[model samples]
Target chain A: MQKSYLMAPGPTPVPEQVALRMAAPAIHHRTPQFSRLFRETHEGLKYLLQTENDVLMLASSGSGAMEGAVVNAMSSSEKAIVINGGKFGERWGKICEAYGLEVLWLNYPWGAPADPAQVEELLLQHENVGAVFVQACDTASTVAHPVACLGKLVQKHPRTLLVVDGITAVGAADIAMDRDGIDMLLVGSQKALMLPPGLACVGVSTKAWEKISQSDMPRFYFDFQKERKALAKDTTAYTPAASLITGLHEVLAMIRQEGLAHLHKRTELLARAARAGLQALGLELLAPAAPAASCSGARLPESLDGKALVRYLRDTMGVTVAGGQDHLEGKIIRINHMGYVDSFDIVTALAALEMALHRFGQPVKLGQGVAAAQEILLERYPS
Target chain B: MQKSYLMAPGPTPVPEQVALRMAAPAIHHRTPQFSRLFRETHEGLKYLLQTENDVLMLASSGSGAMEGAVVNAMSSSEKAIVINGGKFGERWGKICEAYGLEVLWLNYPWGAPADPAQVEELLLQHENVGAVFVQACDTASTVAHPVACLGKLVQKHPRTLLVVDGITAVGAADIAMDRDGIDMLLVGSQKALMLPPGLACVGVSTKAWEKISQSDMPRFYFDFQKERKALAKDTTAYTPAASLITGLHEVLAMIRQEGLAHLHKRTELLARAARAGLQALGLELLAPAAPAASCSGARLPESLDGKALVRYLRDTMGVTVAGGQDHLEGKIIRINHMGYVDSFDIVTALAALEMALHRFGQPVKLGQGVAAAQEILLERYPS
Candidate 1:
């Protein structure tokens, strides 16, 4: 039997223990039992983020939290700087425009990391800019930005808050919110948390809360202030994605037990193996400058269609990876390494890629990529 | 070891089969496999609703569907009639008001069902009224409104559509939307579908879609048209609550196997037994006139605190039930028997109530209620 492998950046494979926790009989959200569980989750999230800020848990996708961050922290016509490097980075600009905010978009090519110096110059020019939005690691291009470097720049401007969409970056790599001077950090359940996609946690710094207080935005469902009021009592503003939160509780426990440093190290090793294996096969890296630990982007061989290769891997080999979106479509394939995945997943993905390339009439020898990945895995585990 | 029981009107007990289905490995939503599964779910939901209309699946609580129904079908400042009998009914008016709709509220007493004649008169007098919102069964008061009668009245006014919030009513009772002239019907996964509280399904009639096409409302996340467009391709507009939808697939299969008529009959028997048992102990039903088959609401004896009794049942007996909200707080206890529940659950609820009442110094003969419930159960399901 060919067991299927999920290798997507988001909706990543969940640990069986976390999945089973959601399978247990449902509990009412208003009960004491649920409150205790929610509190435990709060502590676990704080520990994971390495922040003392109040992290608000919401019931929608990470985009919903992104929207909340925009409406809650910025008012209409308020100036904000958005670093547009990839699809997710571009989302920050789109959301700002939607909320009637004056966006100063700093555009960058896909697969290119954002330059902190460029951001600093923009912030200095537009001193009235109330917020700066960027992704810790843009999943679309598999590029990681220097959040700590950007945080240092934004922190110099006390009125400007730095909001990091750490949806794919948080657990895969350590960019501690408090230590890095990040004003807001967003993390979703599916990416690196080993749970299904629904719950989104937004860690809000006190500085960000001050901006949220003065903002008069039309919001009911995604109101951060309403959520903050409820969260103080260990409840959500609305009915939470309860089962997802329950799953989050178990995954958080798993994270706490494994420790963030170890989890990040494992992901680093997986990404390293994937890069080593793909490079060994003569494939060019898409984000070779600063590839994200969560996922690796590689340019498909000139003869191969990335979309068709992705489909073949999913349908024929039972291995699921992602193709590029928008303009990058049919050009790159992204192999995700974060969340509940290990060295074996890298081998499977590389092996499947090698077979797919050979089937597509490329000059790829069998076991070449797999052998390279195995070398890295063995050196790390040494068992 | 004692096992806890979930007996809430919503977030009811989920079957083990459905829970286990959710625990299976995650699947990417954009894949062909997921598209096929989503299409199958579309067919299953249509069968459950007994309608030929497009039933759109959403990723939020049932209230999100309710909000979508309001914003999609009616324009700003358009007049609408709302039947306010309980918490859920009141919510319909509030959502309409939030969107700047001119609401003509027909306020019914908490336990009283809506009168069709009043709605008919309002529809005739206010010919410009665009829609009428009513709950098939108001969970807060355990009252089932006469939706069939109401639909007939609203149908006479071609411009007015009948929107039914069937969150607690759809699977637990028989309300054929097409036959009863309902334009929009909403259902949640958590209630009688034996799943958790995240996914909502909205069935839209051609008549309602006509209005939705012309209506202009500010919406992004709850855009019905966007969801309908994506659903045509067998996917959701946003990243769906995948795990909950996975659970829903199994529960819908269970519903199909049990047959809609049989499932409704089972719920009817359970509610009947619960009412019979509680009444035999000299407790009066809160909604004696038109009690909902999904749950039974009973007024506490003058000497008992309904809140304390509910807490005792949960904390001591491991049987969880609900207490009344708003004005009826500490006056009524709502015993739910919907979704993955059987006759045994009714007996357990009655037995725990008897024990709780006895401990609370009330004159409750221990086995009197259980005996009455057993008699009804035997008649309904005699092996």
Candidate 2:
């Protein structure tokens, strides 16, 4: 109805430039123009995935890549360990179990980081474990995992690959797949990359690729070997979702231009500003108290109607934020500071939150949250 | 350097209007705006597919939908009849075999359509042929199969389902799914609909959905059950490719505005023009003996190299035509008259073919092909 802001964890507001590029004339995949774009995106995806592993582009959502990571890299009858603290974390176990794999999942309380110790214990205990799956950031938890710590365990068990769903963490979080020793790092264009969600970018290590060679899994579309063969020519094995790839080419170019380090820092600053604003508003964060952070979250104040507040913000103000899921539903609200976020956006979100709370009969000091958010913004990036 | 033209069968050039819609803005999948767009596209896809079956959307290529049809509708152990007449047709057998299914293929030469009688014979002979899979128009052969006729046989069997890949034929061909008794028909946005690829739409009948209820083939990403469940809410089980979905919505509006009959007629007229132009150019069609009758398949002249000629048109004159695959490679060239085709486009393709042939030292009369194409266009439309 209006110029909307997607303050969700993913499918975040896309850049105008990326959208324009997607609208660019489609090039035949077999042609040199497409070949060049495909090669660059493939290379850029690997770099974004931060791995020396061969990167594969999939014309699917982030979950498709997650399913692809397990099915192609491990036999269906094999066992795998997954961390289930939130929706996406549970997704790994669900995908593995659907394939008849024996899954050892360490389920943590929602809104808490997946305990690495428990994951390590599960990995050591599960004799049939062929892979260890974890999401670097669980949007449902509003918490980021210690992937560098988990990567160490997977490095020891070379046969058991550590797969990370970096949907919410790829560009926003500091992930160096090579340095962190991640076997399969999965990402999509929609999240922190500031593009749409039609493309899933997966980095597959040599170890993961070798597992695929022996896998008898019945996969045709997500078959890593077939995709690898096509990737060699900088083309997809099957017809790809072309416009999304075109959009990604633009988004990747922009990312390269902005520099990964700079984007990460910008994202972190936005997250911090949001967190500071919520604290100043006398709200508790839904996430477990820890140094590890992701999207800023705040528990709904007792006097504020969470649903009504969020609805009012969306309808009256033009700010769209995500409400809590599962157990945390109706108890907290999440304001995503990922994808193309800057200090101004952080201040705007807080200002909208203040207005919505007031409209919902939870009257607060005028400009309380915005003032604090602006204070953090000035501290981090002074005007 | 110039605006590209995608002439591939699938992933054809996307409409500029649709691209503009995609670039408009992002919205959350669960939001009302996205749900509205998703619902519109779903309903529009059903109309285009001409099936009462629920049309499900997947964030993958056409191949993913092909995989979904095979894996979700039938188990790995069942006997299935596969038709392998071209590259895409071969995929039916390959995916089935990969899944350990006992396949009885009615193999025909790649360039020709498999006879429906042969399919009937195979079904009669096989003890337990659970399903049938085929491409309505195999892009590799540029030939249209008698899907309606094949559906008749499978319809009589009742136990056997007629699954057709309408990926290349959906928006262009006249294979009405419900009218033809097609149980499952799959298509992507790239082909006849003139949208960039990224979303694969599958129309599954109640029978197919019933099989899906009990299917044991392991699946998570391309899970039809999950998608079907989410369809009830007019949203996806997971985050959808919003921008691509947005683009698809706009494309559907265009298709609806043009009406299916009008679009199909336009395609037919252009196809006839291309065929006439190729004939006037004195080129032999590889499949002329039993031509597909839709896409013109011209055999390379004796002195002209097909691959080099294709490159010459693309590089020198900015025309992108498809070269053949596998056995057909470098032996023939394909001119598509599917999406967004007009008499002028036919003229451009004819001119490019003539120039490429001249460069390759083929004997050709100046402007002969273009003139013939124009004459055919005038005669057909009386303008």
Candidate 3:
């Protein structure tokens, strides 16, 4: 019998309870039953985001929310500074350009975080800079950008809102939206929320809302002001992904039960264990300086094909992980450490990696990586 | 114990098997297994749409696809003739205006279908008319517009594309996109597809694609060209609503087994029975001249509160239907006839309505509407 394990960064394994909750009979969106659920879920989102702002739930993927952030917070006449560090960061620039906004791109190498000082310099140089877009953590490179630092920098410019795509970082990392001065924080349900890949929630600060009201951009479905007004009535402007929102209600309950601090601690520990396990195998980290707690990326040896290794793990071993994109393709492999993942899942991943490497004619000890991961993971339990 | 029955126009009850299929473990979107499922579902959509044109599945509600249709098919400099008959028809003009397109609105009274001669005259008068937007069936008024007739008129203008919001009509009505010369046809999953909200599919003809290529409208999440390119790869441009698409695969399979023509006939038969039954209850049909087969709307007696009657039917009798929106808020009630509905469901709706009306102090004879409906519904199983 073959059992599958999903270890991808986003679209992480959904908890059985959450899946069952979503599987239950669908409810009408306009009813008091759904409105109550929505209100509770909205409160939970505020708790998770550590914000007092209104969070709008959208029936779309993270990219749609990212686009909403662009069109709502900035007008076409204003310029946007996009920190292009990875695939998702590049997306910010593309979305800005698509909306006819002039984009000032700050290009960083893949796996490297953007410098806040450089962004500050650009903000000083440009007059009508409306917003700065960056990822809290880019899933492509598994690199966490300096969100709080960037937020502090952008907060100095009243007109420039700090838009952070916290798709992989919101639940996994400790990001207080208000404290961090994040004007707009985007979260995808499939990521740290431990759900499927349809629903996206954006926590919009009062600062962002002011900019949104003045923006004359072309938008209908992703209209933030309309969503905000609907949220006040405990509903969405459009028909929400009811099943996903139902699932979100369950997931948020679990998060509330566990408490945000404990959840963030657990995620960090898992990521640390994963990195230690990979390091024990003599692998170099992709983003050693600014690794995200959501997932970990490591470079494979030149002799080994990372693509085939990932394929072997997924197709043969029934363990799904992610291979690198673009220039890093066939050179790196990424393993997730957040969401419903626990200590053993990390060990299983390390164990599978060791076996897969050994199978590929590499001289590797089977339990070497597992032993290293367990040493750090044991901290979760008693001494 | 109360067993609730959903008879709303949209968010139609999902079939048990389809819900269970979607409830199964979430699958990673970027995989061969998902690709195969996507390809199969795409083929089924083509069959349902009755078109060889590329149908792009988007991760948003039907309104989002409505916006995509406006931005992609027409440029800001071009004038659009919007057939504003009801709430949804008026939405076509609003979306056009939101994107900066000059909208020439042909305003018809709610529940009244637009005249093709008027649209033809407008097309002839406006030199740079890029498109004509109308609904195949406007859900709010339950009116079916003359799509085929409008198509014939719009076909004469090489520069003008005909976009139809077939949210409640595609599967319920006999809308053959290619034969009708429709440039763009939009479908929502919740209406006749027996799925939840958050998934919308747009069938784009070659004529629409030609206009789309020349249009330089601002769009990112609802970009038709990007979606078309991804559909060629058997996937969507963005992360698809995977769970909803999974449900859609099962639903389309059911549709295929039932056959499109049979499905349409069944819907029309149900709508006919519903209208006849409501008329028997001494009620007036909302759209007597051109009622959509997807759902039936009826005007209530001025003495009775339509909203309270609807609430009693839903809360007390455990039968859920729709109340009117906007000006008709307390003046009308709507009952759905499409999506997983049979003759008996129609009878249940009518019986509940009769009981609710009786409770609300209106003279409603129990089974009078049922007997009238059964006379027509009996055609489904005649010897």
- Give a tens-digit lDDT track for model 3, residues B28-83: 99999999999999999999999999999999999999999999999889999999
State TM-scores per candidate. 0.52, 0.51, 0.52
| Residue range with the least summed lDDT across 10 consecutive positions in model 1 chain A | A374-383
Two-chain DockQ for model 3: 0.01
lDDT of 2 by residue, B68-187 (tens): 899888875568888888889889888888888888887777667779999999888876777899988888887778898998888888567889998888888787999998888998
Clashing pairs in model 1? Answer: none
Candidate 1: chain B TM-score against the reference chain B: 0.98
User: Distance (Å) between predicted and true CA of B257, model 1?
Assistant: 20
Q: Which 10 consecutive positions of candidate 2 chain B have the poorest summed lDDT?
A: B374-383
Instruction: Tell me the TM-score of model 3.
Output: 0.52
lDDT tens digits, residues A133-160, model 1?
Answer: 9999999999999899999899998788
DockQ by candidate, in order: 0.01, 0.01, 0.01
Q: Which candidate is the best by lDDT?
A: 3
